[model samples]
Target chain A: MKKSIILFIALLGLASVAYANESQIWGEMRIQNILGYGQEESLKLGVLFTMLQSKYFAWVFLGVLLGVPLVFFLHYKIVGPKVFPHSHKKHYAFNLFHRTVHQIAAVSFLVLLPTGFIIVFGDFFGGGTLVRMAKNLHGLFTIPFAIVVIPMALMWLKEALFNLEDVKWFMILGGYLSKEKQIINATQFNAGQKMWYWVAILGGITMILSGAFMFFLDFKMEMLHNITGLSQIDLLRVAAILHNVMGFAVVALFITHVYMSMFAIKGAVYSIITGYVEEEEVKILHNAWYKKLKEKGKF
Target chain B: MSNEMSRMKFFCDDHRCIECFACSVACAEAHELPTGISRRKVITLFDGIEGKEVSTSIACMHCTDAPCEQVCPVDCFYIREDGIVLHDKEKCIGCGYCLYACPFGAPQFPRDGAFGAKGAMDKCTMCAGGPLETNSEKERHLYGQNRIAEGKVPMCAAVCSTNALLVGDAESVSTIYRKRVAGRGKGA
Candidate 1:
């Protein structure tokens, strides 16, 4: 009888323990190990994010900030502005459709760059309501900025393609630094402009891909990473680096492009604004394009 | 002075944990933490599988190389001489970058405001509060009890009935854990 009682108690204890474990599991269903997120991904994200918070990024930001004006100053001091001889004859430099697209692209870029910079350097300004506003605006502008770049790239595709003449133009530094009017044979867009177009197109695509992933983080990208033989963390690190590096490089190129169009070349800004350039200006600057226009009797 | 230089650590022996969740409750009650935030949580993996059920209580590991400190955008986190990682609440912008950076998901943000507004981060301080006057009411209110300042164990560690959670200098904690595992006929 004593042996039987001991056995019954042991069986009862085991049953109660199992039942308690089941209840415990049901109670803590929401709690998870590492909260169901990959620890390595967080570590990599932390490391990169810390890097952005460091003084290195600040110094690089300062360099890019000050470098643009210095380049412009040197150009102004050494080369002086390009002042074409006056001509009353007007030529259709840009059509209404192209000019409209250019204006929209310029406006969107103008909004995106400042807001983007504010978010990037939020610590210096002491992040608060303004930084939050900048972040939202940056996200909002990305849509229009991304949408406009694709159509604009397609529209200017033919003229933006590089040819043998572009090599000559690049060798002479696009004739901007020359004392005399050294004409390098070029079409509607110069070699420098062609390079800028390509950078903008490629960089825009990169930004969109990375930004979309960051925005919609719920995507099952880990499965894709598994198939590709890369850990999720590795993929995230690569994406983050590409997005940031490409974004900064394209921003630098943009500043130079703006300075060239607005300050260095006198008629360039007016041409974009009014959709017209002087006939003599085109003949002197874009000789190849002018000859082609004449041959077609479109001038 | 040597104790100050000593690296502090926390260890949870799964063999001893009963999954009672008293550690989590004790921590919350001791800290007076808001309802939505939990400083410690007990997670049971593969429960009700006869021999496979494993329970462990987790909080901030106070990592030797902490990811939270690395990822804070405002440079809010600071590590003490004893390796206790803490952060300044005033500087924290509630951007949730630290949440992404932490491997243990130790960082907690209170969703008190509308549209799911995230309040500043709150985490396990190892019973050490923020950069405030130690044991003051302000410190207690913002960061919870500073048991470490009083030369006492953390409340969660203190109230653990099973003694699963152990906290101390690295050498001592490891020694205790090593002996316990040995008693159970397991490799340390």
Candidate 2:
């Protein structure tokens, strides 16, 4: 009996030691603890911040900030009377669908960029009031931006697929930077633009899949959820990284594509915005389609 | 509440715990842990003779003063009345500081992300409720184990087939442990 009591005291001493050195378990349990706290406050704060950074607002700002001068320069310097001296006319099929896609893409990209930046940089910069504000807006705008881009991807799926023509155009560097007036039978969209389209579609899908997995953490397919074993917050943390990386990559691609379409290519802007291009310019750039349309008296 | 202590503690008889993973399975089931995350793990530390191996089951000790609570940026970890250190999953950022802070490497992260986002910090919580209101679905989904609410002993202690793992009030548990150690001619 005395021996049993001594053993009991030793066990009690060990238990006390475990309690005293609780910090040893610090590495094991911190993330789940933080997640529990975030669910109470940060998540709601982040969603709210996401709304203020909506693509619609960002696009409108971009239009006022950058589009005004771009439109003026393109209209006056490139496609103005001094350049080609022809009146503009609209192409029904190309004008409507192309313009709509442009607008949608512009808005989606604008919101996606800044919101994405915040998600990536918020931790590095410290989640201050401004960072918190930006996070909320980033989360909010992702919803509509994702919605518009999905259908846009489906709508343009046909032209974006890889083909032999794309290879030739890629080999020739899309004939934009070079002074070569290389005439090739081109389709509705050029090779460079087609490449950009594919990048945007594929990258956007990656972001959406990763993002959706994060957003509906509680509602995902049981098998997948069971396999992941990640908390919703953990998935969001990962999605935030992917979304930011893809968002910036897409934005960079957009900047180059936009610069090419509006500035580098002389008649491209007019064709997209005013829905028209001079018949001669079309014949030079899109020889095969131009010939087909002219034979039908459609150009 | 601060003065209250846990009724269950895990004690591994160093002689009997042969480094097998049976305790891990019992823990996973009791907690309903997803496949990739194990709350309890047996770690073997072999030293001395070539033929001899020493292994111990390392898990959350349900510390009375848990360090996980201190290092958490969001303050999500909480010590239950029973001294189990549980945490909320909603606030986790997957930053992985807890892994560094743990001495026994009890915290395990799933290698799921491309850039190595530490999947939520999952560790033994002594089968106690987390930050969620006890017995809620949110608690079940996030924290996994909730044995304390069910009025049962932790599964790791109960299912240890070798009777190597023991759980109960700290005092009673120590008494049993002391007797076993002395009977085996071991020192404190």
lDDT of each: 0.72, 0.58
A274 in model 2: Cα distance from truth in Å?
Answer: 3.0
Model 2, range B68-186, lDDT digits (tens) per residue?
Answer: 45544344566666566676655554434344333344555554433323455677777776777888888877777578778887778777777778777777778888888899887
Model 2 DockQ class: incorrect
lDDT of 1 by residue, B1-188 (tens): 37643788989999889999999999999999997578888888888998888899888889887877875556678999888999877666565566555656577766542233455678999998989999888899989999999999998889999899999888889889988988889835
For candidate 1 chain B, which ten residues in a row score worst on lDDT? B110-119
Report the lDDT tens digits of candidate 2 across residue range A105-166.
67766776675555444334443344434544544555555556656776777856666767
| Candidate achieving the largest DockQ | 1
Model 2, runs deviating above 4 Å = A1-90, A93-98, A123-126, A223-245, B1-188
Query: What TM-score does each of the candidates earn?
Result: 0.75, 0.46
Q: Which portions of model 1 show Cα errors greater than 4 Å?
A: A1-55, A85-87, A216-219, A222-235, A278-281, B1-4, B18-57, B94-123, B127-161, B185-187
**Model 1, span A204-270: residue lDDT tens:** 7788666544433222333555786543333444455566677777788889888887778776788
